[model samples]
Target: MIKKLLVGIVIITALALAGVYYAIEQAKSYLQTPLALNQAELVTITPGTSFNRAIGLLVAQGWLSETPYLRLLPKLYPELTNVKAGTYQLVAPLTAYDALAQFTQGKEHQFTITLVEGSRFSEWRQQLAQAPHLTHQLTELSEAEIAAKLGVDREKLEGLFLAETYHYTAGTTDVALLQRAQRNLERVLKKHWAQRDAALPLRSEYDALTLASIIEKETAIASERSRVASVFINRLNLGMRLQTDPTVIYGMGEAYDGNIRKKDLRTATPYNTYMINGLPPTPIAMVGEAAIAAALSPEQSDYLYFVASGRGDHVFSKTLAEHNRAVRAYLKVLRNQ
Candidate 1:
């Protein structure tokens, strides 16, 4: 009777081991199974979310199936439970194991917002308002308030942020992104200012930025920037009015009807280069690094005037007579067109 009891105990132990092996095999299979995703989807994991809760959310969304084996995954691979909090992108044909790996490795989905050169600060704000997956903290704040949040001392926010593509995760704040851009602008401006030509007519780095914004608006051609800078620099040296039309348009603000009239040029405003003696009180637009560099170290030339060639380029001139001739040629081209 005692021998029979020992045999029964051995049999029970064997069955328990078999059950454990089967459970482990099922968990491994579940981990390797592909998710039920028809297309790419976004999954947001908020801060302090637990691993089990995240798995439950996936199962509820039908991306994953309800199974006891999913609970065994963390026990089998301890690292699978260390999921980071952020938005993740799950693509089809990806196995459940790989998706979990993405979470564990903190491989969050990235989004980009590009701040374009020659665009106004107001336009940038509009873009930020429309950006997806970004937290809008500055929607109700005025420009001055936003600047204060960014730790900027100036009241004017124009030309303070750099024009570049900024990358962010799902929960990134608009003010945070702007802060990065502002820091980048400060770093770049400081470096360039230290390297600028000593003989430049610019009184400070701010003056260079102001000039760069003008150059950014004047031309879109990459090769014409330095030459455009040269023309403006020459005008400044000769104490002549810049006579730039972009500044006039900026000064007109909402009153500008896509045309600059004789009276508009005669109107006195701080931004009107035709009426002002030097650079505008502030930058009129966001500027690129190339424009800034050109402003700090303009090309050495006798050019003082430029007009559109009607061929997506400019005709630069050293004398008023030559500039008038080029202007007539530009008008003729426009008339023919």
Candidate 2:
């Protein structure tokens, strides 16, 4: 009976020792294993996620063993909570510790967003609705709702967001990005606003932006910015109707699709320069710093009218007769088609 009892004790001790060894070995795997993970996949996390969500993401990414280790690891290393929310590349041989470290200290995955010049807020609404990384849903949102939520009034955000590619981490807020863009516009305007020709007839920075938006819409040609701006400036100086097409298009609002109609030209809105004697109620398109500067410091010229030649370029005319002739020629070409 004594021998049997002693044998039973020895077996229990051995099993306990084996279990301890196993636990320690698993714990040490983070140090020795090489990470084998893909860089292309993005792991997106939200701000203020619960601990359970964090653990679930780890397990889903194969970063954690999903056993009690998921709970144990965080308990053992409380610093795991410091990991920032972003897209991350999960590779292998990396234990939960290493994975957590990578998330906290390593480079985050960046997403790309391109805001084009002359793009409207309604268009941005669609783009933002489809974006994957931005943590907001704008599909069902209206123009007013988006402006209110993002704090970027549609009229103001127009021609205010610079046309460029912006890189941001996953889970970036649409509002934050719009604010960032607005801030950039403010900085650029401040610098160039002072250098503007004091004798120019622009009434305010708002008026300058309004003209800049026109310049942005009339031509994509960098060389043409100063000239286009000059025409508008001359019109303002001469107290002539700006008669820009963009404003009439802006007035079309929801009716505008890909095509601009002649009937739409006669329809009037506050933005219609053909109907309004002065600057539009707001900018018609998004403008960059360069366009804004060109509006402020327009090229000195006698040109007052321009007509597109069906090409990307336009022909500038100094007098009404010259403009009418060019218009007749372009219209003739259109008729020939």
* Top of the candidates by TM-score: 1
lDDT of 2 by residue, 42-158 (tens): 566666655557657866766444554444455556666566666776644455566666666646867788888778766776787677678775567666676677666563456
C-alpha RMSD of each candidate structure in angstroms: 1.9, 5.7
Q: How does each model score on lDDT?
A: 0.90, 0.76
lDDT of 1 by residue, 6-82 (tens): 99999999999999999999989887888999999999887887778777778888988877876777889788788
Q: Name the regions of candidate 2 deviating beyond 4 angstroms.
A: 1-39, 44-85, 90-101, 137-157, 257-263, 332-337
Residue pairs with backbone atoms closer than 3 Å in model 2 (clashes): 33-93, 34-92, 34-93, 35-92, 35-93, 36-92, 37-91, 37-92, 159-286
| Span of 10 residues, lowest total lDDT, candidate 1 | 64-73
Worst 10 residues of 2 by lDDT: 30-39
TM-score of every model?
A: 0.94, 0.73
| Backbone N/Cα/C clashes per model | 0, 9
Query: Which segments of model 1 are wrong by more than 4 Å?
Result: 1-15
